[model samples]
Target chain A: MIILEDVHYTYDGIYTALQGISLQVDDGERLAVIGANGAGKTTMIKHMNGLLRPQEGRVILDGQDTKFMSVAEIAREVGLVFQNPDHQLFLDSVKKEVEFGLRNIGFTENEAEQRRQKTLASLGLEGLAERSPFTLSGGERKRVALASVLSTEPRFLALDEPTIGQDAHQKNRLAQMLAEMNKRGRTVVVVTHDIEFVIENFPRTVAMAEGQIIADGSTNMVLSNDEVIERCSLAPPQMTLAARAIRNVFPEVGQRLTLLSELEETIMGILGGA
Target chain B: MALIEFADFSFKYLGADSLALKRIKLIIDEGEYVVLTGPSGCGKTTFCRAINALVPQFHRGYVAGNVYTDGKNTRENEVATFASVAGLVFQNPENQLVTLDVEKEIAFGPENLGVAPAEIRRRVEELIELLDLEELREKHPHEMSGGEQQRVAIAATLALKPKVLVADEPTSNLDPKSAETILEIFAHLNKRGMAVVLVEHRLDLVARDASRIILMNKGRIVADGNPREILAMDLCEEIGVGVPKATQVYKRLRTRGVDLRNVPLTGVELAELVQEATSQ
Candidate 1:
């Protein structure tokens, strides 16, 4: 659905954030981009949604070069949710905030309202529909920002740290929402430092370091690589660590288990028979 | 001494209908490490603000009860007076930062208090080594990474030498390793006899370090106990707080009538427990 061919990006004509980056994201593929701060994760996502054009090389979305497409035109296909909610939220009320993006995309007032309600309801923000967004908490504001993008119904969705202030239940809800979106054949890309969230949800993973892609493979393959995780300043999720420790005692147990349910099942297979 | 005390306190924000905090009675002692957690808008932030007098003073809310910090009445003391008693590290490090360079930012707090240059130097040097921010000391605050900026914010807060540190979701924006480092720093500070009140939603990373866990919901304290006690209850999952992954596995095993020896909180502990059980 999206392809970045040897793309390079720089800020202020001096600081380079992406260097010779190349990757192909297939249609309806759920991928996670993981990295430390300044690893070009955010810069890379901006390229996907036409927020920033690469200084060198091409960012092609749906077989069209992004440089040739207007941001509004590209936004119809790719919706980008920034890391900070405050940067994106400007409207006073929650209902209006979600409606703004849909309205911008030339949706009728009736259609925009329908999407606004459905998107807010999907993220559990229906109760706060009338409240001022500024009065909401950090987590609530994050949901509103996400709703604004989801209301646009873009074919390719890119989220930067979508689970920043969310609690466990809220995180689970978001994961489920993303899964539903993926099921509907929309391409999803998440840029995050949230290793656990990625391990549990995203199937494909790419790790970046110092403005370049260092590792790209299955989520388990990339996250279990201690060297890559160390280079990215990320800690493996507790489930992976626990699975490794179990593997030490019982070598039959695998080392790549990333979810608690998977680890539990493995432990039961080994111990429950006893 | 009790570092902070709230007695039947309730507050309504200016122009708001409902009270943000309601009938909260709590006490945090000197040198205690407490983790306050809840779903968003559950009044955890309001409680943190109450500790440093940001509740009624700066926030301008209607108060119904007393809040005392460092044995001083919150209403009687100025927010500036709480500086040496309680220091706040907000969620966003960029929002809290003021000075240009890391060194100057760390020194900004102490300098404002008229601390001697030699004393400021000593404090700044101590925090730099404590946070391992020596490499970032000369870098501009705006130029550093999110982790580095948060570390600088911590160093700046430590420069105040407050008896209590109230950090509101300090690691929410950081990566796992950086988040662990922040918690380790808090644990170290707690050992030095500083009362630490951390408000965080990511309990899996910070739970073990806290001696006490105070769970709030809807402007009220719903649960208060040690880490093990709190995680053992079903309330953790009910309240949307994440119990440790190890704990979840243990809980699942116990539910299946497995005779687990201990409720392990970490991966190593869970592995060892499983090994012991299987061997038996």
Candidate 2:
């Protein structure tokens, strides 16, 4: 569980990235931070794992304040998978990258190697053990990054736009992987502008705009509010556009849906002469 | 009226033994949304560069074909003038953007073309509003997100108001929603009659609205059709082109003993199909 209390983050002593961000992410909750390009999403997540300390208030991780914790200590409790895989992955091989974190935390050579193999196999990167990390594609690099974090076995996982720029196949693979990881009871917080991913994957949603938590609730509830969506400079998902059209003509079907996934079924139910 | 025409166009980079493109004959009508896609290094980027004369000029390769743009042969045209009709936004926004501030960045193109100061100012302001970049005007390029920076790069391209805008993996730097906005902007431009070509592997976002889909493979346009038609081909999977969720669902249901060969193209259509099939 994580509790953010009046967290305000400013960089370079001038630009305020996040202002008064307060939220509680319960244990086992898959929370999504939805926003436009620069909606302070990264600033909020950086505070969690001590990448950036809050300039004001407190960021408490399972009752331990982040201010009192070192970044190395934070890494043990929360694994941060950044959008750019190049940042976290420093090893030559896919297998070693996964084991690097384990070895750095002072695990024995055997134990680190054991964790690396297991993590690689579990993520379907078993054959990539001998493969060079540099030779991999964008999607493969991201997977290697996730594999590295998962190997360390952190209690909480935070990702920044994990599916950016990936093809649909890659995106689906990521979605499936994240869903499987979430089902195992790891608290997953993803900061993403990928509306479709949010709609299909995360049941809960939080929208950030101009350094503020503008909306928070179910994915459907938070996304349907056009005022909040526009303020965030974000567009509605494909299904939401269709849902709104149906609502304009017949409000009945619109009331029962929030996500495009749910809307698709609801609309089909209506179209089938329900 | 075709703004760009390719006659059995084939190209191979300098010193390359194999052809990167082969026997490609095509015509892009002005203001059309044509998405060029395939697996990485499959000649998508190579073919895109050919539009703006990068193939033989910047690339210094042997091109054994004719490429005509606006009735002028691409090989014979000046690189600068051909650049005016076709603007290429590269895969990385950070690489494409060369300016410090948002306003100046947008006006960079018009200024380079020697537009009047007042015209440049007007164009920049209009672009800021059009692309919803008002608040970020004074901000530096590095201060923006990957998605914001991509938008800025795109807005700068629009300031030139080129007849054709080709972005090579632009959304590969953005989140899905921002990708959607970018695609929406592409659709808006196509509606306004600006010829557009996007080299993207994310077929789902452009699947519904794109007027034409050209599937490439090893420097060849293997398959060409509308969105649904291209997705329905088994070759799409083999060539590594992604299938939308609807197409995937449709393909799965067919194997699972459901008889919906008519795959829905978009999420909405898929939903409707599922709802109907289940209820019945």
Runs in model 2 deviating more than 4 A are: A89-99, A107-136, A224-227, A243-254, A258-274, B1-31, B37-86, B102-139, B142-148, B158-163, B172-181, B191-193, B201-204, B216-222, B232-280
Give lDDT: candidate 2, residue A195.
Answer: 69
Return the clash pairs for model 2, or none.
A165-B172
Expressed as tens digits, the lDDT of each residue in B1-280 for candidate 2 is 6788888999877645567789889999887889888765467777887888887788777789888877778898877777678888875788788889998898888898898999888988888888889889788999887778888998998888789998887886565567777788888878888888998876767777788899987678898878777887888777567776567656655554566536677656765555555456
Tens-place lDDT digits, model 1, residues A1-274: 7999999998998888999999999999999999887899999999998899989999998888888899989988999999999999998899899988888889999999988888788787778888889877788999999999987868899999999888887888888888898899988999988878888789999999988999999997888898998988888788888988989878877646877899889888878765
* TM-score, per-candidate, Cα-based: 0.96, 0.75
Off by over 4 Å in 1: none
lDDT tens string, model 2, A226-252?
A: 887887666565555555555655556
Clashing pairs in 1: none
Best by lDDT: 1
For candidate 1, the lDDT comes to: 0.88
- TM-score of decoy 1: 0.96
Residues B1-280, candidate 1: write the lDDT tens digits: 6779998999888766577899999888988899999887788888988998998899886899999998899899888999877999988999999989888998999899899999999998889999999899678887888788999998899899999899999988887777888889899989988889999887778878899999887788999999888887898889798788898898898888875797788888899998899888
TM-score of predicted structure 2: 0.75
